[model samples]
Target: MKKLIINADDFGYSAGVNYGIIEAHKEGVLTSTTMMANMPGFEQALNLHEQYPDLGIGIHLALTTGKPVLSNLKTIIDVDGNFRNQAYYKGSFIIDEQEIYDEWKAQIEKILATGIKPTHVDTHHHANLFGDFNAIYLKLADEYHLPVRNNFTNTDSNRRTTDGFIYTMETVIQSSETLEKVFEEYNSVELMCHPAFIDKFLLNHSSYTYPRTEELELLTHPRIKTLFSNHKTIELTTFESI
Candidate 1:
């Protein structure tokens, strides 16, 4: 049976994002989300998490788009304190390995401090996938003993989702037939999605804004529900499940 992990990212970026992620998990087929420890709406996200205990939570190991959880991170952050990365900003940047490690540790420790055990672990802008950061991240995951989303394993050299079968909102909205083909072809797949209500923060901080709403609508559609209806046929799962 194929296992599909539908994970919504950026749970604590803002109030609007928190609302969308919570709404998706509670009412839609969304089974999991990755929480940002250093984001603006982190507290609100944690509070909502208490309400939906079934939604699998994971640490969104952040090194981008905001200030570091640890103070005085000179190497990783710019003069303004924003990490050299943004939500939609994707490229290579020089990193101080030690500083980034400490920052991620702080991020994960912040989550554990709340007594909310994460279901798994992932990253922001996939910062962990580059340079010596991958080694640092994997070491942290092992140390924390948390299952990582897509670690060093590589079946496809592209995206880091399960077997590299990550799908986009454009594909989902434009053609369900394409998705069906994908669903039939893969035994395991991790579909990453971002759903949010855009505010000034998202608009200014991310190159991706309005499309987030579109993603939210597509994932919550009733027709999409029918696809994962039979448990015996396909396992709708999270990293915590298996």
Candidate 2:
């Protein structure tokens, strides 16, 4: 009874990404997606959400890109008055976890303001999983009673459905044997995926490129859909139902 939650990250990153995600969901195996609250294409993402009501929407809690939802942050910003990339946070000593909580809560509130309650939560660059901010993530999830995505790998012994995720790009790799191995390895697992059309924003502002298109292709693959549709062994589900 293995369950696969195929979640597309960065839904609100841009219009191209939003279209790609919708395509992945409508024509493929994407069961869930997480959106950036402060991103430019947020409204477009919401429009897609309206068009496809069943696509599970979650918060891609941001601390790495775009402007903060709360104004005038004392810490967690580089000298350029913007949040630093994931690399800086990995070694940061001056950041305030409370600020992270406040900012993240505001991001969630923005989504709620649109009357679109999120189904679950995860973070950009996995900010919550790496440092003191993990406490903030737990606080929000517990307070809201929402599912939080943990970075679980296939090799972990206690790989429950909610434990984390196995990535298609990193693990599946366009290989049928590798795809089969995932079903063999875990009873229930969530797959974290990033699928986009690789717009200028992603090219100029982010380190990630190329693999996004590849992941989208892999997610929409006919074999992958057939595997999930077979239904007896693997079920594709959202975290809310898991």
Assess every candidate by TM-score.
Answer: 0.87, 0.89
> Which candidate tops lDDT?
2
Least lDDT summed over 10 consecutive residues: which range in candidate 2? Answer: 152-161
- True-structure RMSD, every candidate: 3.5, 3.1
Off by over 4 Å in 2: 152-161, 168-170, 173-180, 183-185
Q: Which regions of candidate 1 fall more than 4 Å away from where they truly are?
A: 86-94, 151-165, 169-180, 183-185, 230-232
1-242: candidate 1 lDDT, tens digit per residue = 76678889899999999998887777677888999999899999999999999888988988877888998688888888877755323465565689988999999999999999888888888877666678888789878888776745654344324653474644643344655566676766677899888888888788889989988887777776764563355577777654
Per-residue lDDT of 20 in model 2: 84
Best by TM-score: 2
Q: What TM-score does prediction 1 earn?
A: 0.87
lDDT of 1 at 108: 94
The superposed Cα distance between candidate 1 and the true structure at residue 72, in angstroms, equals: 2.7
